[model samples]
Target: MSTKRDIIEQLEKNYLFAVIRGKSFQDAFEIAKASYEGGIKNIEVTFTTPNADKTIEKLSEYFGDTDMVIGAGTVIDDITARIAILAGANFIVSPNFSPSVSEICNRYTIPYLPGCGTVTEIANAMATGVEIAKIFPGGILGAGFIKDVHGPIPNIELMPSGGVNLENMDTWVNNGAWAVGIGSALTKDITSDDYTSVTTIAQKFSDKLKEIRSNN
Candidate 1:
């Protein structure tokens, strides 16, 4: 078993999370496999998909020995968080922060990345030991939001999800985002059943991130 610190380090080092949401288990698995092949070490399977728990389980078991980290996303409550944990989720993410969910993740020693739109929400989540907070609908929040948040609380790590693409990812990173979650942008090719295209896009993003970090 990996300690919470190990997973946190992996998350920071890898820096890219491919948010996978598919119509079925096979769909999500194929997307995840392709993303991994393209060098994305972190995969977040959202609960909106059918049988999401099963998908997480299969992905965890298949890549259990690899450096890949699997997490459960869109977790709305403690019940769902517990279910995902029992299914082998390395971390739990929510659209918003919830104390019950945070407690469950704490009990299991798994990272809880809850979404926070304001400094108050971020501070409250951090007060309960959340190390990283997700900025949902990041398109609207923009990179400036991150800079603004860090101005006061320099220790908090923020991850922006949604509206993250190759063109603007650098801006987010430049503003000090710990990581960025790419969902539709990363999985768009899956709609055409073109798994190879998915891998290519993932690789493009991976390479882009490397270039950004190298320059920084």
Candidate 2:
């Protein structure tokens, strides 16, 4: 099994997490597969989807030997966190911080990335051993928030989720985002059964990140 640090490094190297929400298990699986094919090494399947646990299980088994990382998102409590881990989630994420969820993730040695909107929340999360704090509603916070937060807390790793897209991805990286999470931008107008657009969009994102990293 990969260590927590190993997974963290992988996340940083990839610099993008495909946030997937599907109406069904097959929908989730296919989207994830398409994302992987498009060079997305990290994927976060939100619990909002039906049979999310089963989807995580299948993803873990399918990508068992690859460097791809599968995570559970929208995880709000310890019970859901534990369930996701048991179902083979490599990490856990939530829209807001939860102490119980943090404790369970720490106990299991899985990386926990909880949404934090303020310096106090980020500091509180880091105090509980969180390595990366997700800046949800990134569009609202904007890339400037990362820079602003780094001024007071220089070492905090911030990954922006929600509203992150190829157009503004460079700005986020330029402002020192640890990583980024993309959702509907990757699927957009594509129908449930046709994920070709997903692959196309994911590739663009992958390429954009690479270009940004190279320039930096």
Candidate 3:
């Protein structure tokens, strides 16, 4: 198995991971490209959409040669993980901690970000031999909560998702969040009428992240 640092390094290569959850695969593809062009090299396509496997396969085929790292989100169990992996997902993300899902990802040598909201859950995820955990509902927990949690488990890599925007991105990063998972804030304004809007938003967010990194 690859070391946790190895996975962290891989994730760090692409600071932004776009979360795409909607009804249209075509729209998702366009949104993905917009993000990719705007400097985000990672994308997470959720499984709740229709023909998600097909969407993953299409994205894998389309961006196979690029440096972009495409992954699957909302992965629940081992079966979904296997399907996503087969469809060419580079990683798996879940909304809640699932050892079975992590084990499958580990078996396949793929990185998994298991969702954890509490100290016990974070410890449990680390106990499974997976060091990266996603702090879900980041809006509710806030950056202060993350800082408090890391006081004891500084070794744990916590990626906060949900309610993350350009405004508070730096706060999370500065407060011990290894990375952040951003959704609607980055894609909501993007409509089929104009694709440039998507790329513009992505670039703005990327620029903000860079500014934050520099200041920190």
Candidate 2 least-lDDT 10 residues: 186-195
lDDT of 3: 0.83
TM-scores for the candidates: 0.97, 0.97, 0.93
Model 1 regions lying over 4 Å from their true place:
none
Stretches of candidate 2 above 4 Å error? none
**What's the lDDT for residue 87 in model 2?**
98
Predicted candidate 3 versus true structure: per-residue lDDT over 73-179, tens digit per residue: 99998999999989888789999989899899888888889888899998998888777788888888888878788799888878889978988888888887777
Q: Considering only N, C-alpha and C atoms within 3 Å, which residue pairs clash in candidate 3?
A: none
Q: Model 1: per-residue lDDT, tens digit, 102-203?
A: 999999999999999999999999999999999987998998999999989999999999879999999999998999998988776555677998899999
Q: Write the per-residue lDDT of candidate 2 for residues 144-174, one digit (tens) a residue.
A: 9999999989888999998788888999989
Two-way lDDT contest, 1 vs 3, winner: 1
| Model 3 spans > 4 angstroms off | 1-7
Q: Which window of 10 residues has the lowest lDDT sum in candidate 1?
A: 185-194
Per-candidate local distance difference test: 0.92, 0.92, 0.83
